[model samples]
Target: MGHEYAFDWLDQMVHELDPQRTEPERLDNYQSIAIVEKAASEKKRLILLFKQFVFREQKTRQIRNSVNHYLSAAVSLMKIANNNLNQIPTKANNFRLALESVFSCLSEVSAFIVNRYRSHVDRDISLNLVNITPDAHDLRTLGNRDAMKSNLKLSKLVTEAFSDIFSDHRGGEITMRKLDYWVSVSHAVTYPNGLLEMTTPFEQLELIMIERNFNSPLFVKYLVSKFSEGIANSEDPSSRVQALTFLQKTFNQIPVMKDIIFNNQFEDLTLTINSWFIQEINFHSERSGTVFSDLGEQTQKASKKYERKTSDKVLCNLTVDQLSIFFKAADLSNIISARSLSAIFQSVAPYLSTPHRTDISHSSLRVKSYSVEERDKSLLIDIMTRLTEQIRDL
Candidate 1:
């Protein structure tokens, strides 16, 4: 269904260019985009080359509505996915199906990138280098008119994109190299026999999840789920933590949830932790019967895990009066209880904001929302571990 939608969008984009009336320059660029995309369906290296071309062409930018259609479509689909990962049909493979359009549309966008050597990107290093650095007398050459501009842009684009993976240094400071070096290396690697362009599973997925097209929340969850393979396969705790850190950084990049998540210090995180905290709290409270009537007899009896679902539903859907009572009665001698209180506070604080948090915090319980990913995960792990120990009997 998703791929079909993307194809319809692509057809619409192609039809937008009136074939009979379209000028040679516009028509050629459009056709080139389609061809490049068709090739890119097989090679990831084409994407890197496409980016280089885009930066170069935009130097004296062409700002056409028809030209922007591909970019617009890619970005729109991304937003839909990044906005909410949970809502996407995960179990039924609906989310993965939708993502097919993403790769296809992005490939088309790659084709739109205008550069003198757009046609020969798939050629060998020697041939591409000759094409990139053309002779003035050669009819096939770029004529050197826009050579400097294109070369400079390529230098800038490659350096920026691969700063982490590869870089050139001069006198301890990073600087541009000869133009041929950039074009040569870029072309060399993608050639069938050249340096093997290795990519991680994450990197491969990233290629498909272009920010413009797959920005929805469903995509965010998919990313997390994908990373879980890396996390689970690793026996090392550090590797697992790195996986989570990677997830956190990537999640932060999604536009749909960025502001709200970064703004309130991930108040939603509190809700998540609170669900567990609340569940454990109820389980212990009902079993011990310490905080309820008939407490002595219940505490003496064999404690079964709390089975009453009604109170939990009410706990989740707390009214202002009920929330205030929960906060008032909470005894937070342990960290789990404290975090649980914070989680409960977070859930209902929106409906009954100021006085609740202020009143709850007035007691010795200090509930902090760690803005940093490392700290939040560390603290949550510590609290949850102690929480499990504390609820051993329950």
Candidate 2:
């Protein structure tokens, strides 16, 4: 609506270009050709501005103009095609293709805006994010949960708009460090050396960077600090699971203090985890949640209704030889002579499958070893019984 002259020109231009609105010779009409050429020239300039906007440049006015330009171009092109993309004639096939290219570009830009942009405005009034200042409290509380409604209503306008733009194309070659990129983007949006320049709180900036790159060392140290702080504030057990799982998986990935921090500190780590969680035991502690001291047997049951099929998450850790032994035992109606188990397996080896029959050995003094967990409570308890002795020997 602000670009009334542009809008009026577009409506008149599209109307004149419509074959139904003019004579059969409309394609050859000098005036029609001139209008199309003028639109083409204007579209070219708008495209340059649109590209800059997509690249996270803060050309607000030009972006608005280009957005309107796309709208105008799309409407006119559809009218010329009579809503048929495939039936576009050779007389103006070039124009049709150009319109399609612009529309496709606009789709990606619009999708980026939808997926990321949080408008920093109220009642269509600009908040000018760089000028608004936050105190220590805001920085401390950032990302603890969702952003405050009013702050999100008008905060980090530039960051929000362009964060996805950075994330969406992160696979491309990057000339700067990941943290450097965010800092540069902040400068690009909020501190362009004119108007009002301000800085994002270092704490908030670090939090944002951590969220973007979850495997960052800063995040790992922050988690280690939070979990080791002698208390857990949140009631969510997933936090505990996440912290412990990530630490266990990426212990060596944390750079300088891997061995000093985690190699011989299992006792301390377990104690810290217990301090935070032993009493609470997750939200299942609430009476409203279901509890079954014993679910008894999991009897096989058929599906009663339509449900999405999901892959079974069961983890198989047994060797093929063990499975073959189990199969033989099952086939023998669960009869097992401890002395003859290995001999029986060796005898049956030739009749079994290739991998399954590879080897069989009897061990009277077998050492139990479990290096991976398969989400079994009883199995975990059995493994825990051995962990202390194993660590003591280490």
Candidate 3:
């Protein structure tokens, strides 16, 4: 019966998309469920990509409406089951049981989707149906009332079965990434065009729960405790440094959740530590130096001078094409060490936003198939020009 309703709901949705399409006599139960689940997954990907904002908005509204329809149907059926208890006890009980099962499936499926894609979906969309399917709060209220007056066992079962969907009550249940299979299982939460990416599981989990509008008190507490331990272990500077770096990154990445993640306890502990003073001092020093010193002026002069010269023009801004030409000349002359070239690029690639696969190799660049972005190109030009100049002076 649950599958039948799911199939009908899916069919109705399809008809909305194509009015002329004919409805089949019946859809396979698993196939119907799979279709809806697949739709949810695809919608999530589209929302993340934001390719067609208007279309996605319409689809989200349609999904919310479908969820409401299911909730309303379930509630009405449950009420009927309760009303006919005395006249048709067995049938009513069976109907009620079936309704509870459907609700369980819905809640679990919602939770699973939310958990699986928590890192990818935007928080606002996650709040809707991307990550979280809104709980049947009204239905839960009705069940509570029924339990109080007459049917305690079935009502309890109904509530207990889907209790995971209730807000704020299940903090300890948030999924944690298991470390044993971290290499194979861990994924960098990435979005369209690489606009956003999070590599760490902790940050991924933090964003996931934040988007769900869930506090995850247990996770927060655990993080806070770890942070405090890091700060207090003054014995090991490395541990303290790692802790401070983590805190700084948390502030940078998820500024909105900083207060929640680093609550009053963290605030007090951080106050006791004096590393924040160094940060403030360094920031002021850097700003003052940039404004007062001739270093910036000299650097600009050198860049302009290098840009103007015909022979030196390539050194000012290097593109892949320029790099290819330079590499060919350098490789032929054996000016730069061929063996060290890949290693040097690998080290500075992230800083320059250079993209590459598993590793950089000399052969890959021989045909000029490898490409480097403009930003990285200029930096690489600077490095290579300086190295060649140093070698010449030597």
Best by TM-score: 3
Better of 1 and 3 by lDDT: 3
Report the C-alpha lDDT of model 3 over 1-394, residue by residue, as the tens digit.
1233542432333333221232222333555465556556544543343333224335543434444444344334333323332233343333333333333333444444344433332221212211232232323445323222243443343334224433433322222111111111112111211322253423333343332222234434544554565467545544454455555455335423221221111222222222342343234436444342443354345333212323322222444444555654453344553222332332222222112232223334433524545666677678778989999999
Best by lDDT: 3
lDDT at position 233, candidate 3: 57
lDDT per residue, candidate 2, 1-394, as tens digits? Answer: 2343333444444444443444333344454446556656655554444445545535654444444454435434444434433444557644454434433333333333322322211111111111122222222233333332223422343233333324343223211122233443344223223211122221333333322333323334454564445225535544544444343333323222111121111222322333333233333233224332221111011111112222311223445433443434343332453212233443343333333223323221011111222434345455546867899999
Candidate 2 vs. true structure, TM-score = 0.23
Query: Candidate 1's error at 251, in angstroms?
Result: 22
C-alpha RMSD by candidate, in order: 24.3, 25.0, 21.4
Which lDDT value does model 3 have at 79?
37
TM-score of each: 0.19, 0.23, 0.24
**Candidate 2 lDDT score relative to the true structure:** 0.35
Give the 10-residue window scoring lowest on summed lDDT in candidate 3.
177-186
Error of 3 at 285 (Å): 21
Poorly placed runs, candidate 2 (over 4 Å): 1-6, 15-33, 40-91, 94-185, 188-205, 208-394
Candidate 1 total steric clashes: 24
